[model samples]
Target: MPIQHINPPGLLQFDAMSQVVVASGGRTVYIAGQSASDVNFEVVGGNDYYAQSVQALRNLRTAVEAAGGSVENIVSSTVYLKNLTPEIAGRFLEALAIACEGKSFPPHAFSLIGVASLAGADLLVEITAVAVIDAAVAA
Candidate 1:
């Protein structure tokens, strides 16, 4: 794994994310957007941002693991939040911490965007990620 997480001197650092991630010499894995839906495509959380965020992050972890990588291998991610607010962001951070089993969330570059809606009315968050794993480690 040749991934370097950097938070430049002048840039603000965050516990949940890295300012930049540089990865080389690995198999790139592009994970599709994962939401709070279960295997049956039923929304797991209803009108609860924290619950939805937890489910979404869990789904993302599953996707990465399926690609023979873990959350630590993720280099970048894009988060889409419907009706974003400070409270919602706070809930998301809490959810992320829980999803990581109380460990620090992976230091992956992240972009959060606020949207008006998602694929479904109940969906509150969706996450898409990109990860890199050693060629031999790929499934």
Candidate 2:
């Protein structure tokens, strides 16, 4: 299956995202919101935004890869945090940018929201993503 990325002309230079993603005949995987919690559901970071964010992304990668997709196959992502600020948001984007490193990762659609709390008191960040895996590649 071939994935098409849409980008319109005359957009600002800072726009780093494709307008949309069109996948043809692919398997869809919806991962549950992954938090810093381990398999036992114990929070990995205690009131730490950066650490929790990293762990959450790592968990998201594992879940996606287990379903036969890699981080580059992620089409969308939603991030939730207990405390959201300009600085915190910058940190979040910076972390993802570092991981991508000029690779093509489906659509760049994503969100970061501030919440009162997460699943646990120690947890600070949770993330969820949807990936499209090529079925033909599997067989």
Candidate 3:
């Protein structure tokens, strides 16, 4: 594996994500921010944060796979949420679990940012990720 997840002892560890990630000897892949838009550029979820979150994560997965990598290859991510709150964040986590096929999301360095708006009016969440994959896999 080219990626290593670490939650140092002193740092507050969360089951859904890792505090740190170490990537070695692989081609770094930078994924653009993905929202709930579908292949037709239409938003999949409307006015529903959880639904949009799930769709956004699914889009992120699609991008990673397109780069010849899996969600497990993700080393870092930045999540942007519109009008975020604790309850909304919980919903996002739930959506993440669902996106990961009922399993916990792959551990990775992550940042969550509350935003006033996104590219689309209906988009409630957007995810940007970075992954490291073997050169052979990328070929």
lDDT (Cα atoms) of all candidates against the true structure: 0.85, 0.71, 0.85
Candidate 2, residues 67-111, lDDT tens digits: the string is 988776777778897778888886666556544434323345577
TM-score of each: 0.92, 0.79, 0.92
Cα lDDT tens digits, model 1, 1-139, are: 4688788899988778889788888889999999999998899988898889889998998999899888888889998999998888888888877787657567689888889999988899999999897732221
Which stretches in model 2 have alpha-carbon errors above 4 Å?
Answer: 9-19, 99-107, 135-139
Clashing pairs in 1: none
11 Cα displacement, candidate 2 (Å): 5.6
Error of 3 at 61 (Å): 0.7
Q: For model 2, what is the C-alpha lDDT against the true structure?
A: 0.71
Model 1 lDDT at residue 126? 95
Tell me, by lDDT, which candidate is best. Answer: 1
Q: List the residue pairs that clash in candidate 3.
A: none
- Over the stretch 25-109, how does candidate 3's per-residue lDDT look in tens digits? 8889999999999998899878888889888888998999999888888889999999999999988988877787667677788
